[model samples]
Target: MPDATFKIFRGDRDGGELYEYKVPIAPGMVVLDALHYIQAHDAPDLAVRWNCKAGKCGSCSAEVNGRPRLTCKTRLDALPLDQPITVQPMKSFPVLKDLVTDVSWNYRVNKKIPPFTPRPNVEWKMDQREVDRVQEFRKCIECFLCQNVCHVLRDHEKQEQFGGPRFFVRIAGLEMHPLDGLSRTELLKEELGIGLCNITKCCTEVCPEDIHITDNAIIPLKERVVDDFYDPVRWFLRKLSGKKH
Candidate 1:
């Protein structure tokens, strides 16, 4: 209806500031449209990383009004237009420029996860329910919004010790797959720092895919980590067998 004011971050890893731009709102206009308008008419040098302006690409992830969201799917109508909409890079990652943050750290964490190893001499068949279980994890678009929102990474800066929620979801798919033989509970307990998560469910709240990240992926993984490392009976058995998780 009226013009919407956008306070978009501008600059690089060195430093940056929010430069305001006024955009005339249109019906069905999303935040990305306003950003494109700003790019064309106001600040040509503005660096906002985006692709496929639809929600699926996840390339347009940024903080809108201090909440991590995909700008492409964030409808301007849904936001309060009376005040300036603050668009900034995800705080969990280092800003490379404007709204773009360096997300390569996610890739590095992903590399640490072992690939799916199917059990030997196993039937290729699996129950439909089993397929459905892991399929939920496959929906992850790697927006890294979960990682950005997670307190472990966002607040504590535990990148060296934690793999963040995105990787936990990836590990969930591999670990839960009926045919997968490899066990990543050790990886989860040690490298990914699964114990660090307090299950605030902030990651699930920000997920555009609505994949139940907390209930389905992270919690079950936490249980696996506990069962493997904490259960008294399991601990006793491991000790008796001279085995280490």
Candidate 2:
């Protein structure tokens, strides 16, 4: 019934500022709907990345009211309409344009993880219960909101050293799969820098898929890293035998 104000970020990698716009709110209107209105009525040149628009593709991610969210799923009525609704590109990555970010870093990090290699001569079939735990990780749509919220990537800027939560979830799926033959513990420790994560659980809070990034993926991976490198008994055995247990 009333026009809601939107403070949308506009600019490129060098820098940018929020530009305010007013759009007519409709019943059950989502933030993406408002953005489409702006693009059609106000700023035809505005850039936004989206696909599916059903929250399944995870492409319409942005910071709404300073929180990482999928704009397509964020309802206009849920926000405080009295003031300008702030929407900006994710801060963890470089901005390509208004409301669009350079998420290519995530791709680069993903390439380093070893792909799932099933055990040789293993039966193709397994009980559903065996895969039930790993299936939880498959729900991830690669939104990277988890990555944007991770302190290791957001505040500390540890991109070179850390794989972020998204990759860890992927690694968890691969590591826990019943037939998977590869071990990623060393990769998690040496390359991904799993130890850098202090288990803040900020990533889990923003996840739209409800994937337990901290508890299920990250913590388990962290435990494997500890067991391999930090266990005092194991370290002593390795030192005495000069062989890994």
* Candidate 1, 165-234: lDDT as tens digits: 9999999999999999989999998898999999999999999999899999999999998888889998
Alpha-carbon lDDT of model 1: 0.93
How does model 1 score by TM-score?
0.96
| Models, CA RMSD each | 1.4, 1.4
For model 2, the stretches where C-alpha displacement exceeds 4 angstroms are: 236-245
For candidate 1, which ten residues in a row score worst on lDDT?
Answer: 49-58
- Per-residue lDDT, model 1, residue 182, is 89
Q: What is the lDDT of residue 93 in candidate 1?
A: 95
Q: Which numbered prediction scores highest in lDDT against the true structure?
A: 2
Model 1 steric clash pairs: none
Candidate 2 backbone overlaps, count: 0
Tell me the tens digit of each residue's lDDT in model 2 across 97-203.
Answer: 99999999999999999999999998899789978999999999988999999989999999999999999999999998999888899999999999999998999
Instruction: Please give the lDDT score for candidate 2.
Output: 0.94
